[model samples]
Target: MKIYSKLTSLFIVVVLLGTLSMRPSEKKILIFFETKGYYHESIPTGVAAIQLMGQQNGFAVDTSRTSEIFTDEKLSIYDAVLFMSTTKDVLNEEEQNAFKRFIQKGKGFVGIHAATDTEYEWPWFNQLVGAYFKSHPKQQDAVLHIKDSKHPATKHLPKTWKRWDEWYNFKDIQPDLKVLITLDESSYTGGENGSNHPISWYHSFDGGRAFYTGLGHTHEAYSDPLFLKHVLGGINYAMGKK
Candidate 1:
């Protein structure tokens, strides 16, 4: 009986140590860049930046550049989905359905730059992005107005930030979206109509978290510490992390 009790205690210790050792790993993020529009030059840069950020932030990162995004099973495996400068109608009906289902599952999404230029025909994607790319005046220096400084993505940013990129105008944005930053048309050369332009914002749609940023016009921008932090914070938040 004494020997049996000692062996039983040893087995329990081994089982507990194995259970603790086998905790699930950190979540992974997959970035897709199927660009066919104005910001093609920035896609590779954006993907590279995301890869670096994943390493810095301790998350596994993978990437693909296919318009045929049709894996419902694979979509469920990722913590976040990042659309990097994809323009034009890429996904077919089945793929769109898969994407919709992916968001419906309460995952996260991050849209960078020309992601606004994509899925103009898909109203769901337009709202998910919080805006669509209408047109840009020209690529030049412009000042970004930080609207809500309390947002995790913009909390560390300055009130009036100047960056060089193509500014996008959106159509019929929902009033419910909490706009994080707007363009200072006065400080910029274009944006003549001065409609409410949302450069960065977050929203909960279809039971999932979404984040979009319209600032990635150049690859260099992604490497900048502040810009990287903005993207990282948005990505992390969408992944349900603080």
Candidate 2:
């Protein structure tokens, strides 16, 4: 009877160890969507989509609508921070500083859609996000030219991808950005950036990594598997997984 009990205990221990070994290291992401200007109704959809991506990809995701979680302690637990359609002055001076410190420590940041329309007064943030939103035409169909198909964020995309979204014309464009995608001004109206209009980019900034994509303006974009995969690739790149 004692031998039977010992055998059962040993079997349980072996199963436990096997389970532990099969588990991968967990990575976490924080989605911040505090909006001080035009708030996209699609924010909730975007958040839910990211949560789904995390679940399917074996990562963890958390969402926030306030700047309270910018502290070193709170931000420490996250592998990346993503600004999901955040607009205009979302963070206070203190929170900005905290975020700067967090990035200086080699953390990651991903920006989507209106993230460029935010923090106009903060030059550092403009550079961090890669560009400032100058203007955009009405939501219409346009062709996006994928500049670097080798990038994980753009690899799945076609050489010429046509889509309907609010196309932005940017100002204060950073010269050092690795542009992954560009807009074909001939394909749409109100394209003020002229021929070489960059739409998505990534770079290393102040000891951290940064990626931005100008997609995700519509609710349908959140439900798109291709768009979601693009965003996930950006997240993975920011998290140093790519």
Candidate 3:
């Protein structure tokens, strides 16, 4: 009996040590860039950029250009869904319903650049993105007016950021979104939205969180440290992090 009791105690100690050494599960995000309309040439670059961000920030990242991954089974592993320049109607009705359910279950979403150009008929998507793409002139240098500078996504940004990229005009702008940054129309041209052109925003939708930024359109954007931080901040925000 004494020998048996000693062996049992040793086994329990080993088990406890093993359990204590186990690492916590990593947070995962899916970067979906399916475009049923115009595809951006910078999609690959953007994917690499986001994957690097995940690596440095201690999160798992997956990329998919197909809408077939929208099933509940596949999406179950992800804490958030990021649309990196997805354009037009990429998801069918069934997939759309599944995505809606995913967000409704308290998942998160992050949109980038031309993500606002997607899903014009989907009201839920419009509200989630805060706007729909309308038009823009040629790419040129412009100043960004930081509206809410305290947001994790915009806090590092300059009060008046000057950069050259393809700017976009928007339609169906939702009032519920917390605008983070706006374009200073007078700094450049193609001033469609005039004094109220919001380029970045975030808001809570349904039971989930959503963040969108319209600042990453060029290949150079993926390499910019500030722009990368902006994207990372938005991603973290959507995932309910800082």
Candidate 4:
């Protein structure tokens, strides 16, 4: 009986050791970059940057330009979905409905650049994106005022961040959004919203997390350490890990 007990203890110890050696399951993110309107030349750069971030950060990333992957079955495998400069009405009604269901199931969403220019006819999508892109003057330099430094997205940024990108004017801005960064209108040309213009924000909506950033029009934005950190933080926040 003593020998049997010793063997059992040894087996248990070996099992524990093996369990400790195994890695935790990695979180997965889907990067959807379909554009029915204006396509961004920076999309490939954005995707590559995100892939690098995932490789370094232990998350997995999958990119898609087709809306067929928006089905709940496919989307369920991802912890979060990122709209990387998606524009115009990219998804069909069925795909849109599936995406809506995915969010309602407490998944996550991260919108970069022209994601606001997507799904104009879908009110739910509009609210999910937080606002719609009205127009932009041109790609230029602007100063971003950190509104909520406590947020994971803006916390790494200085109080005043200067960068060059295409700045967008927004319409139907959601009143309940937790603004993380605002545009300093005086620092740039073609300001429309004046002092109240939000450049980045995050909020909990419809049983899920949503984060949006108006930056990333320029390829260089993806390569900048500060901007990459900012985007990674937003991704983390949306994944509910921040």
The model with the greatest lDDT is: 2
TM-score of each: 0.89, 0.94, 0.92, 0.92
Model 4, range 126-241, lDDT digits (tens) per residue? 89989999999878889989989888888888999998999999999999899999999999999899888998999999999999999999989988999999999999988878
- TM-score: which is higher, 3 or 4? 4
User: By summed lDDT, which 10 consecutive residues of candidate 3 come out lowest?
Assistant: 18-27
Ranking by lDDT: 2, 4, 3, 1
* CA lDDT of each prediction against the hidden true structure: 0.83, 0.93, 0.92, 0.92
**Maximum-TM-score candidate:** 2
**Alpha-carbon shift of residue 190 in model 1 (angstroms):** 1.3
Residues 37-88, model 3: lDDT tens digits? 8889999999999998899999999999999999999999998999999999
TM-score of predicted structure 4 = 0.92
For residue 71, what is the lDDT in candidate 2?
A: 86
- Count of steric clashes across candidates, in order: 0, 0, 0, 0
Please identify which of the two predictions, 2 or 4, would achieve the higher lDDT against the true structure.
Answer: 2
Q: Which stretches of candidate 2 lie over 4 Å from their true place?
A: 4-8, 11-15, 18-24
- The Cα RMSD in angstroms, rounded to one decimal, for candidate 4 relative to the true structure is 2.8
